[model samples]
Target: MGEERECCHHRTKERSEKEYKDMINRLSRIEGQVRGIKGMVEKNAYCPDILIQVAAVTAALNSFNRVLLANHIKTCVTEDIREGREETVDELLATLQKLMK
Candidate 1:
């Protein structure tokens, strides 16, 4: 990521470490879920069960995206607004519109 796009919130060493750990933990869980799905496919699991697992992974990904987007808006976008960056607000809105679709 570009330096200019860095999150406005200043991260202490501890917070950085915690965030990294949390992300890694979440990713690992998602990885395990994906592996489970792969195994289910190989074993010819029931279609409904496979669909349920797929839905779960999609929900998990959407939840993760929501958290990241919330953080970005709270820190970066809010800072931009306070610093007289009206254009950034429009840019954010446009980006969100795309995401919603």
Candidate 2:
């Protein structure tokens, strides 16, 4: 994927900093949430409470993905369009669909 873009592109920098940082931050929070969930389980906490935390983690991951996907569309897909590589549009669409599932 990195090979697809030149070294000095704004999209590359934006993606590297903005989207990746957001994802890493969210994943770190989710990791902490998972640890709490494990502690809850170890302490014999209520099942529903543990389930709620699990749902929270899932939602966090989904939110992270949504942000990443939006950035990908605005940057990578837009670049592909500008470069007249229509095939990348299909690839991006397919990837988004897979991520949604």
Candidate 3:
């Protein structure tokens, strides 16, 4: 009943400490990988080797996205839906579409 009311401001997520730490660790690793690639370039490493490192970074980012998406679906989306916010589902779909692209 009260769910039908309009929201004047955007919602925010409150992540658990574990989730936050996990994401931070993942990003730190990715950052390290990027720095390593830069070092390789500085030393004139083989193109193929540098490409492999870049691929590894890509995989790490994808893994991060998967974890984040799962958390979003479980927490934010679930709560929004329970509160009668069907629009959140559409927003989720759009975000997924962008991620896939």
Ranking by TM-score: 3, 1, 2
Which ranges in model 3 have alpha carbons more than 4 Å from their true place? 1-11
TM-score, candidate number 1: 0.76
lDDT string for model 2 (5-35, tens) is: 5222343444456546767888899899999
After superposition of all CA atoms, the RMSD between model 2 and the true structure is: 4.7
In terms of lDDT, model 2 sits at 0.76
Regarding lDDT, does 2 or 3 come out ahead?
Answer: 3
* Model 3 residue 20 lDDT score: 72
TM-score of each: 0.76, 0.76, 0.88
lDDT of each: 0.76, 0.76, 0.85
Show pairs that collide, candidate 1.
none
Q: Which sequence of candidate numbers ranks them by lDDT, best first? A: 3, 2, 1
Backbone clash numbers for all candidates listed: 0, 0, 0
